[model samples]
Target: MNFFSASYNSNQDLLDHLKSRGFLESETVYQAMKLIPRGDFLPVELLDSAYQDSPLRCSRYGFNASAPHIYGKCLSELEIEQGNSVLDIGTGTGHFAALASYLCGSLGRVHGLDIKSEIVNFARSNTETFKSKSGLNINVEYFVRNCFLADPDDNVYDRIYVGAACPKDYVHQLLKALSPNGIMIVPAGEELLKYVKVDGKLKVQYLLGVRYSELELPHQHEIQISYIQHEREKSLKVLIPKNGIDQSFRLLINDQKFSDVQLYILGNKTPINVHSFIFYCRIPSFFKEFIEPQQINLSESPLVSILLPDFVTEKNLMMVLEYVYCAKLIDPTIFESNNSSPDQVNLELDNLHETLLYFKIDSLVEYFDNVSTILQNPQPFNLFQDCQSKHLQMLVQSFNKIPENIGTDYTFHFKGGDIDIISSETVPHLLEISDFYDDQFLKSHCESILAKSVEIDNVVCLYILSSRLNAKQLFRICKEFIIENYPKVSKTANFQDLDKELLCQLLQDSCSYFQLLFDRNDSKIKSVELNETHSQNL
Candidate 1:
């Protein structure tokens, strides 16, 4: 047999092996796996074991292509359809993309991104050969970019699958990229692997019991040397929040003379209500006392307390404490407590609000408001305020900034008192605030005014407002707007196609809309339709 056929047969044999090992579930996926030759994507030396169930190291670094079974499971989880668009993050060797292209058929598209340009180039050549040999035309695009950073454009994709484990903050970026009702599968957590989905709402399913490595930004040479120095010092225990873990660092000193010193902690740029510390400390022995036994309640601030030796100077202790607090404020972690109470949660929130105000994190105030809304009780708010929480003051200041011209078109109108009144520019500011806070009531009013205004440059704002509204409500509003003004807008606007799909997905209770769109008669909307056959496979 030729190398290609030999590789294909060996992969087919491996699929049978995995099935026997209970790694595979569906025959359709198994058949798809057998059709795509894995050897075409591997190096010559590794070609002998191309069909093996285990992962193979591909580069000088620890970069490795996923095992056949893992790739099969991911594809099976995706349950790709004939014409769906798929985005594969960290596309190693293009093996997964090859299978995805086959499953998606002639009408589908697949885009793969990898950081290494060399690997991407290699994948391109392999894909070209595979297409020629099989005579199966498939569309695949590869880009070299850091996956950790957010993409500038909002290309709402149908399916997004990440090969690397990402931090909690990166999850929001992935969710934003997904089309409403679209599914995303990611491996999350620092020490545990959890398969999370952002399908309409966030959901998680813990798949494997193994922990994957953290996805870190590329470090510079100078930063690497600095980190080496930092690591060499006696290690100091630093507690970091779930989101801040990657950015946090610990300081260690070798001086034994001033070991047991009292220190005060402070914060900056840190989230409000975090329990950080100001305290006296001794080296290794004192670290034990500062470490909390369990995760601090949402209400409690992180604190560090240390018992100092009698001989330690208060002046030196204060200097060390100030430095530690500065570091803590920059990267604070949630304190842990066994018996957290409602009062504690409020205190933490209050502290967090004050901290934000101190640092002037204007955008973070909105985050605080969202948190406050979730808590939803006067006592907690009051308790938080008692702790000198500045969040309420910030909220009040923010509320006062709401412009009077908000929700009004900038046009001259005749008043009943025989006076002509002109609208103001300040109105759009309210719409900005409404969007920030996700205020549905205010957004509807602002959208109505902006939709009618002749000077409004873009209709995107109105579309965003429509997105927040439910299908029936949004449709009612849109229908009313269209009937009263701009009746022919939808027919001429190509971008409205996405808006229509968004509305349909939001409004319809039954799957009839999808069913109709999938019908061959609907050519215009076919590209956006969800294939029922693919759903069945999932």
Candidate 2:
């Protein structure tokens, strides 16, 4: 990757330069960035510098449109897919919002928010003018509101981008609005960070360093009745309670009151009562089996009981139903936490992986299979020892198909091959050995496998490992997984042991990167006061 590049003359020139430097990786982002002229979003006086690969002052309120490269990096991190609902905080003149709209396409909706009414209006005017001239159907709306306050509902935006430096205190608040698996990128002090919301938590990754104005805070007195009324009006539009559908379906599992079918498992006397509607909705193929002529008895009550295969254990069955009912995965630890031993837990995991595959739940199947496979793989190599004969033998066996002669210097002969990682546990040792030998292929493969093998149980360990190895890609993935499963990952014992600096960074503290500037004897800057916006049913 070109870490440094020269400035360009025009918009197309800048796009080409950024693309060459590996900044504009996504074709969608490239096209959108190319089609939208940055000059249209800038003031007439500053229009001369619009095409420059540098930040330009777009608003009189001290808001600057980020450099084109910055936008490129942000877009690549967000990976805004089609039909996504995106929130652009600190929308400025709506340049990024326009690009995001184009990337998300016509089916997606983009909401741009800014505390300054003038800035909001400017963004609105710019976008309207662009739409008129370009004739591109960009669905985006701008609103005059506090940038820090996000919607309280959890299932709203698919992606969020904060243009200003976000203070740490507000990170959790903003996360409440992101949908599960959604991504948010924001600058915090000197570091640009990306956070992915997974399983109702955040995974944080540090992108780079930059200077950005702190997020504008609304005055305490600005919280007037009108704002509360507006918020209440917005909340009224959501008919279903937050997670209402999920909870309703989840509560139905094994509840005899509403169950229309009883599933009989081998060796278990009692059958598991379940709602037919749930199976019909979630697993249409399985539902077809239930409706077969031989399985159904209309003459009797609709409560039909069918014998399940021997492989369906009671423990595994409940876990499967948890996913079927609400698309939620029961924590794997709960399978044998109270009574089962380690061997039993491993066996249960294997059975669960098989069960998911048998049911054709592709996502869960892949997840459980990965977990099981990693757990059963060989232990990590011992870095302290010299190149042992067995280690060399294993390496040679891994690449036996290579045409080169099997010599003493196996590292030189084994250029690359279909080498399967024995275990994610071996990543740390392999990373060091590969780095020592300057094996880019092996090092990359180790990083890829370590990143892919990230599970809730070992994510914290992998994160700490990445930091020690200075594995940027692996660290990014681990950070993201941690964010998505924060509630669960935080409880892991390893979380409490994270380095203080890393923990601060993970929490999105704006000052984490700037601590080096703080004097040892002098007091540090005071934390930003949080004045949360409230709502009233007017």
lDDT scores in order:
0.49, 0.69
lDDT of 1 by residue, 333-425 (tens): 232233557676556545655544433334434545565443453221110101111221222243445433332221111001111122235
Sliding window of 10 residues with minimal summed lDDT for model 2: 380-389
Q: Native-vs-model 2 lDDT?
A: 0.69
C-alpha lDDT of residue 122 in model 1: 77
**Index of the highest-lDDT prediction:** 2
Predicted candidate 2 versus true structure: per-residue lDDT over 1-538, tens digit per residue = 3334345568898889889878889888999888897888888888777777777765575688888889998998899999999999999989899999998888998999888888898899999998999999977888876754434342378999989887776676667667889999988777899998777677899998888888876542332333443454443231322443345456668888655678888988888987554454456556666543433456746566778877789978988898776566545656666688888878777777777766666655545556555346424221111222333332233323322222223322232122443245555666654443344555556777776678888898888877776666677667767766789999988898889988877777324313422532122222122212222322
TM-score of each: 0.39, 0.45
